[model samples]
Target: MRSDLQQILATTDFHSSFDNAVPLMTHLSAVRPNTLIADCGDFFEGTGYYRLGRGVLERDMLLALYDVVAPGNHGWPHYLESELHRITVCANAYGRDGRRLFRPVDVRSIAGRTVAVTGIIGVQAFNAVPYGQRVGQRVTDPALALRELKRAYGQVDAWVVLSHSGFEEDLRLAEACPFLDIVFAGHCHSDAYGPVRIGGVQVLKGYEQGAGFAQARPSESGWEAGAARFADASSLSLPNTLEAVRARITAIARDLREPIDKVRAPYRHTVLDRRLLLEDIATTVYSETSSAVLLNETALRAVQLHGTLTRGDVLAVEPFGNQLVSVNCPERTATSLVSDLSALAGPMVVVPSPLPSPLNAFITTDYLAGALHLPAVPTGRSLAQSVQQALTGGTR
Candidate 1:
């Protein structure tokens, strides 16, 4: 550990769960003087706040807090916005004309020691983004980019990577880029919270959805890193400075909680049983459009709905704002489409227990249609609407 540096704090994959904003911000504000605050991206597009508020809140929060950030596939476009673009650092992303998309490294004097903070988006994660959203954008191999950056910024005391790649991919990255001191990982939502050392590099991530952060402080060996939850900060009150932001968030959340419908029984969705919720929505879409439906579990979140349902509940269930689109599938390609989708998205919900061989057409999200390279006819409806219908047993 360097004598000049104090501590580093970072959040990853915060998918617009602003319910934690006050406490999180209160904590961040308290620690801002000595702590280097950063985020590993996917900050936008998750709950009703992002869906209905349209990223204003997310952008505002970033402007108010983050010092540096990495871009994630979920909020790929948001990183391009001028305010965020200025703070974003990425080593690999490039435009079609071969121009670097963002500053490869952000060098700052953390205390007195020169520290270089660089970011990289995994190739697989970048490709997972909707094609249209990433038009004219391309990425090189993350390790390749890091190697180039290391040579370019050779004078830094410490090299830290804010990676939008999953935790496992980062372990491999750490092995490849042994020059790195610490790797803060994001994008793959799994139970693995590791400061798992790989070839002398430390790799870990914060608990996602604004619940926690990853922290690093100077240790005798090098840097000791671990995950920290925001539970202690839950009781913290917002300062007068952030009260306005808190009010706006409250107003928007209240609107999102406005009742839209009712449910007779509780319908629960959890990580273990995401398929049940997807199956229910698939049935609704199938019944409405009279077409086979394909829905991946990742498109929707796991939530429990009961009694009076609100827009927030619906959006929480299917947070990405996906729209249903119809795509034609010939008999010859139908089987292969199912197989390929199964491979790409594990254990997806396919309407019709056994897909009919002569399936003429099927319904899927616009994102999936683009991913599959299939021409789609827009149904002029959103998956969130279908979720509402499914729960209420009626049309919106």
Candidate 2:
């Protein structure tokens, strides 16, 4: 390793996967002495950990480990918390009063070079956040935001973006803002972990959830970037300073492992087939409720299941804790509602796949209903409960 080389360690779309927090922190701890640690966003609100701990665990990890972060749509408000807000940077997002929600930039020294770190949430990604959560918040275009930020803060050695705008958008952003040196991506959850060069910019994403991270090291041309998994860093030991954190995480893990149900056959969750599981869940809900059902694929994370499912496993599958609700939609707008939702949420599975024309109402999760601003009546059900029911074939 060159003594003058700068290194950056980054993670994105963590989505509160506390199950892997300890080891991930251990890896970060080992590299903390020299590396600049940051996250691209969506680090909170995914599993039972977030629901049970109410963001305390995730907040603790960020305070202890990350140097800087971006605000993601999943846990948009958490970024506004006083402590987190200090380290959070989002050049494009604004609050209801038309004031900027966070400071536009954070200037940091990495390997003695002045680097300007900024963040932006893509318009589509911001729209994907539940309507109620973002009632008064809004985000501008990423390219436009970057252009303005560069104009004002062009004195830095390099400009880096912690983007929750998905990868493809970042590629275009790199092209639009050629002055940016690097972009770390989040929110899409796709398999593209590119250190792909666009013009003079490098765009990349870490493995999502708690699987791994991406890093950039100074190179002769510019910077060399790539992804790495926690397993690869497991040999490095964490200093005793983090022992208490590990203990707390261990206790939480024990509680999360409590058995919830049993499955007769294994249902594997993969990138290509996660929506199939959602379709199964939607079908089960449709059968029980005798109503049409709609589900956004992003509402569930990819996790496999077999015999002896645990509470943590179920929560990991439907981490948001969204309630299963029925909402009334006018016949005239029902079709457009699904189409608009699909646009923001990527692919969606609507039970009775054709989505009958003149559809009046349907059963959907609270997140989706809130996204469309529909009045939702609680069915006294949750996506977690429905997932367990679907896997176990029980009504509960």
Best by lDDT: 1
Model 2 poorest 10 in a row by lDDT: 264-273
Give one digit per residue, the lDDT tens place, for model 2 in 135-171: 8888999999889988998789888899999999999
Error of 1 at 396 (Å): 3.4
In candidate 2, stretches whose alpha carbon ends up further than 4 angstroms from where it belongs are 1-5, 231-241, 266-277, 353-355
Among residues 3 or more apart in sequence or in different chains, the pairs in candidate 1 whose N, CA or C atoms overlap within 3 Å are: none
Question: What is the lDDT, from 0 to 100, of the residue 336 in candidate 1?
Answer: 81
Candidate 1 is scored at a TM of 0.93
Where model 1 places Cα greater than 4 Å from the true spot, the runs are 1-5, 232-241, 266-273
What's the TM-score of every candidate structure?
0.93, 0.90
Model 1: per-residue Cα lDDT at residue 26 = 86
* Predicted candidate 1 versus true structure: per-residue lDDT over 1-396, tens digit per residue: 223447788999999998777668888888877788889989988888998888988888888777899999988998988999999999999998999999888886664557799999998889888988888889999999999988988988888899999999999999999999899999999898889999879999999998899987756677878998876665677667577778889999898889876663446322324677678888877886789988887787776666777788888888887899999867445678877776665567898878787778999889888877788999998888877777677776
